[model samples]
Target: MDLSRRTLLTGTAVAAAGPALARDDAPPAVLVSTWDFGAPANAAGHAVRLAGGSALDMVEAGARVAEADETNASVGLGGFPDREGHVTLDAVIMNGRGDMGAVCALEDIVHAVSVARRVMEATPHVILVGEGARAFALEQGFDTTPLLTPESEAAWRRWLETSNYAPRANSENTDWPGGASDHDTIGILGIDAQGRMAGACTTSGMAFKMRGRVGDSPIPGAGLSVDDEVGAATGTGVGEDILRVSGAHAVVEAMRAGLDPGAACRRVIERLARLRGDKIADHQVALLALDRQGRAGGFALRPGFTYAVTDAAGQTRLVRAESLFS
Candidate 1:
């Protein structure tokens, strides 16, 4: 009955327990997310976890903060519209128990993450898309809201004049007040008071993208994946590059194979470069991972990707992502 010495295992994740359990849990739980804007969600999730909430609930609540922010152009209510002027959202939520749900290319629903959770808990299906997703959200009692605000509309109009689809180098994540956009998603991973892990991925997809285009955000393994015993992982930036490798799942698999969080994130980015060097040379992709023990690591294709972390003491701050090019 030596639980401390024996290895703890998650569905496909395994970890040495003794040393990890001995590490500081001062702020006993940990929350990590993809970008600076995630600071708010990290704080919100931290509060819930500190109060003995489930990590799954914290992750969902945290993600909802961004989903409701009209100023954040990459996710939720006021996100930049697609090329055709429609603001479609995609989101996914997964818990330590392996239960998961997602919504893709869903229009008019601001709380897309909540809708995704309903998909995971209320229905037998794992995914719902387009009108089906909208219909389901409505059925779930979520009211319709305008996703594309006047500010976003004007930006789409301005973009239409030149009609350029190529994303600029190092696009702005909060350029809404400023048309110009990774700059991509708010992917979060965390461990709760009871040592359970959960993760969530939410985004409005690429700015001014093709109307029906969907990215890694709504795809479980690509955008987010969690194994309560081992850890959880999430990805941001260019969803296309992230999708090609199922980025988040790759990180969790690496952890299962004995790589620490930092090493796992590095290996994934290196593999991505090896597989799509030419296509990803100019694009950005970033990953953030947390082992069940509360250790975390973040890696990216470029230097601008920053992530936020909060410990059990209610303290939170952003960590700059390590880049392969650097």
Candidate 2:
């Protein structure tokens, strides 16, 4: 389970799966995102790319799919609420040109990613928070509606009995409709035919968390980072840990230092493990990266992390990412 052994195992798995795409033959357009739910999101984003949309357009379009999925309890509409029974969303969007925007602890706005985009385009500020974010969204024509559904409220009530607040690894992949999800964040990264890059991250944050709790989903360097000259990276899982190391930005810097997308992601996971030691086993921090050449890869602190990839051919598939622990 050490880093070197894990690297060897991951390398063997990669070899068995297939060789990495050659840079010269890399797809002109590619989309990659976190989790199984990301499959449909990738398809949506890919459609934007096929329709001649910019990377910015592709990422925003993709993130909206998950934000509107009623069955997903870790995102928009039915997301699990905080201990106070309020569902506050966090989201961020960034483009290769360094333009970025974010909203944290935002309430009543389902398309938080789009609001983040508006923050980037309409205001000189890069972030908006709480009531201010909601006000901005409303002024921009976004409708205000309750995001917590009956199922989520029931689950929150059940959670009050034990009041256990331990963060769970990969809980978002569980039976979400039954309100069994926690701490799931959807992060999407894309490259257009023009080779432009963009990334987005959104989530309702950890289930039954403190009322004002905001995770890495809305933090630029922690949840998402994009660079036209290098690549883009995004993370999902326990946000606090990711924030400590600026995980997403670290992955992009590693890629800029000449590592492949997978290697870059793995290197960041290794750093996170070293930083947290044995405690890392109790939480998951998965990272997905896409290089400027359209190559994509993902890595995680533990098993059970999967990402969706959509290539130029319009084929979308889920990839189970390699992990530091067996």
Candidate 3:
């Protein structure tokens, strides 16, 4: 049944009148989203769904899966490092309850952001950074690894051999009128059986980032934003502009304004395009939204992005531009 934005937004009884109510093996109705498919983020989502976990649990579990995979350059484990060769990680988690937790400029500990959640639940702070974040991870019994791996070392070594030291436009060095450029990061959002919303974002930060640069991944309303009463948004590309645009929050609010997920994502991208006219090449992003009713949609500046949803019949599939745009 194709439901209009008006019906989806205003009708409080959609579950009783939609396909979601008829499926016997609904599989918790989880949807996983990321900028790139065949990446760690996708794998993480698959793992969580198979484990019968909540969307927030899936996001954290999936992020950890990404952090452990060495092949993904944008996320943890073997991801890019600073000029100093430290592979610091940044992560954040937000629950439907509006309580949020994050770790920024973290090092040595994989899944550092998950540790931040432990802190969020055990302590009173909403954010943690640097040495403090690392110490907390250690206390939580997270095994310490030399944040840098041989593969990342080799990649950096090869990079140094080239003259690409000039930072990209989206690097934190940019001096824009409103906000600095943001960096690439892995972001995830999921909706579970209980209609609860949760989101998490993780990244090794920008390549050649400053020794301690931290971007929007761990900042609420920037890298990731979730409102159970509305929808959830996760941002990719320049976190700085994402922060100024409040890209994720913008999409969620747009949804509230009656825009479908695709329109909401398009609106956010259009604004960013105007902000970084000439430097638009590197100022890219992907945004995904899922309303409380289990309808899913997303938009991205670049082609080939991925987002997933479990439809009314309970079949879950990894969605990409090839299947969506074409």
Candidate 4:
């Protein structure tokens, strides 16, 4: 046979190549999302990615970022004020290892959720709130910024210029205008490949809300849930009803009872709906869940609810909830 350059090249390539090079290794992946307001909702996913941190670290860091961002308008300093025009903050954290922490109705602390994490780790109690929460934050050396941002101050100025009421508007429909502020919440659920989990939630009360009004953020099982054996869940929506429903815990339990992540979320939603007689179409909640296998799913009433999630394949994407039940 006559030797040719092409034949020589083919033989050399086969000889140099190894049999083990069949598949490329997967990069990291995360699924991120949020409600109408953005920013903080997806920030947790970002923190987790940067640190390769567990769910607990991610949730705390994400919440602190939102709490510190003046423009977010939902969780921290720049959030709309209560009826008297004062800002307040709330936060909570939980680990699947049976540790929990929270701070509610806090004021002036730039990173309320971080303070709450310290309480969970350092104190004997699982929750703390109000003046005591602030005192602890100060004692811990957490920095304090002006309670109101320029955006928030301008919002307040407009409120003063426009009307006597607390600048309340209908978040869902301005025409039907009900509450004064969004009182929206931010939560996270972190899961490791070993099946460990952590969760956190943060928010300011509804703007121009009744003085001393406390929501579900400080309540366990309402804001978030982490169960090393079953799965983890984080809740969003009306706080009181969520607490009553034990929303996140219920979602986790549903998974324990053989429900898939989607079905588990729907089951909890159905429970909430049923509690309200299933009559009010406006009732809403959102959730994300991950099993030991890293299989994940999400559910919500409307089209826009979203969660940030990371998978073993190293693919990260934003997951907008759909009516998996319907």
Regions of model 2 farther than 4 Å from truth: 1-29, 172-183
Q: For model 4, state the Cα shift of residue 249 in Å.
A: 1.0
Give candidate 3's root-mean-square deviation (CA, Å). Answer: 8.1
Residue 118 displacement (Å), model 4: 0.5
Candidate 3 residue 13 C-alpha distance from true site, Å: 32
Highest lDDT among the candidates is held by which one? 2
Where in model 3 is the C-alpha error above 4 Å? 1-29, 38-52, 166-184, 310-314, 321-326
lDDT of 4 at 267: 75
Ranking by lDDT: 2, 1, 3, 4
lDDT of 1 by residue, 22-141 (tens): 223323338888777777898889888767789888999899999999888889989999999999999999997889999999999998999999999999999999999999999999
Name the better of 2 and 3 by TM-score.
Answer: 2
* Model 3, CA-based lDDT: 0.67
- Between 1 and 4, whose lDDT is larger? 1
lDDT of 3 by residue, 1-326 (tens): 32223223322321121332222233334555554332345455556656677777867876777677676665787778887778988888988788888889888887766886786687799888899988888777889887688878987888777737644433432333112122256677777656788888888887767788887788888888898988787877656667778888898899899876656777887787777766656445667777776666666565434544454334544443211121
RMSD of each: 7.3, 4.1, 8.1, 12.2
Give all candidates' CA lDDT scores.
Answer: 0.80, 0.83, 0.67, 0.62
